[model samples]
Target chain A: MFQNDAFRALDRQESLRLLAKVPVGRVVYTRQALPAVLPINFSLDTDASVLLRTSPDSDLVRAIDGVVVAFEADEFDAATRSGWSVVVTGRATVVTDPDEHERLSQADPTSWMPLRDPVFVRIESEMVTGRGLRGTRGTQ
Target chain B: MFQNDAFRALDRQESLRLLAKVPVGRVVYTRQALPAVLPINFSLDTDASVLLRTSPDSDLVRAIDGVVVAFEADEFDAATRSGWSVVVTGRATVVTDPDEHERLSQADPTSWMPLRDPVFVRIESEMVTGRGLRGTRGTQ
Candidate 1:
């Protein structure tokens, strides 16, 4: 019963599943009271939270801690014009527990940047929304 | 003079140039005081503003109008592990003037969803930042 003929809305479970398939997403946060976005490598945790590993000294670590942020990932084929996008929005907190850090460091979520004393930031899966575009009405 | 070895920073002009190369990007805005992102087709205006055409009643139109939002576009090669992402932060305003609307409607910026009485939103090119990742140190 989708009103829009061009796209289909995705449920939370499907959205998280699509998110896990992508290696990177754009994180949206407030920088100096203005919106800012950066693309970073991320992983969908077992609980559906977004896990990001970055350098401890990076500004991203400082900006997102204890704040609400948005993460979005999508894959679109210009030729087929069909793709899906998933957005996860929630509060982000830095994981400081020594044991958890050790586990994550050993597991090693893929990083575009090399890791040396990395900081793990978690974005709770509080609100998830996504859409699948299959080009034209009959394409699906 | 780069602090991060994983990515190279792109200047504003270069970032704007890259923004024009893509047909789509994600727009970040505040939905009920939390961050929200949506992927949509867009074009870069001659003045570097981000132009979007969507249905007049779309939630995105209401959420971003006259507000500070972030627009991001990127291209990546999964096989080569090389890509660039550009983010534009500025105020978004709906173009209400009939003449201006007529001009844009005639030009018809690319739209993923077919346009029926589309509304034009302009995001100013106030702050632009980008990063280029060449995989590893030796790859670049």
Candidate 2:
């Protein structure tokens, strides 16, 4: 997995592993035909789908449903100049199945805020890519 | 400004101020008619333009030049459950003028890795928006 001396390319499994490590990521979607990004806490489903729980009336729910969006999560340490980022690009769809919703509710995905009527938006991990950067001292 | 009990909306000035506090952000652009996001180190120019220095032949330069892109930066504390995020939407342009490039070169924007021949991409702050999340205990 070669990229450069400083950055190492990560494969699909490694990318999904890192994606599940972070509890939050920024969701990129089209707003008014232009791109907009919002940081949201998400849970990685067993199948690698990025699941977002938010209020039913939230703007994010309206904008991202059935849309091809990108979800990115990373952890970077400026002091060490080391970090890894994973981006998942896929079509986001609202989870409307009763059984699946009940199963997810039992899993207890992390949420930043409690919503009275929470809706789940699941982003299929159709394309996953990631990279890790080595520190200046050649350590990650 | 008002958003909800958990999130507070920020004005343009405050948004830019918070945007300057972080060293890295995700750049969102369109790839093959689908949204793609890549984490990149950036510097907020004095005028609020997001400046990125990378190799001349980097894929980002080729993909984002003259295209509208979204840049997002945030600082989140999971334990505290508080953070601020700022998003800047604008068109990215490559710095081609000699005098302007000379001035920017002297400014020394932060770069994750040293590049032999660096090119500058400037994203104008055409639209800026931000939000702050209050901790569960009500402290930010």
iRMS values in order, in angstroms? 4.7, 5.1
lDDT of 1 at A84: 95
Q: Mind listing the fnat for each candidate?
A: 0.35, 0.37
Off by over 4 Å in 1: A1-3, A137-140, B1-3, B137-140
Query: What tens-digit string does per-residue lDDT give for candidate 1 at A1-140?
Result: 22267788899999988998888888998888878888888887778899998767778888999998988899997777789999888999999999988887767555656666678899998989999998752211
What DockQ does every candidate get?
A: 0.43, 0.42
**For candidate 1 chain A, which ten residues in a row score worst on lDDT?**
A131-140
Give the per-residue lDDT of model 1 (tens digit) for B1-140: 13277678899999988888888898988888887888888887778888898777888888899998999999877666689999888999999999988877767555667656778899998989999987663211
Question: Which digits, one per residue and each the tens of the lDDT, describe model 2 over residues B1-140?
Answer: 12267888899999998888788888998887888888888888888899988767878888999999999999999898899998899999999998988888888655767566677899999999999988864211
User: Judged by lDDT against the true structure, how good is candidate 1?
Assistant: 0.83
State the DockQ, from 0 to 1, for candidate 2.
0.42
Worst 10 residues of 2 chain B by lDDT: B131-140
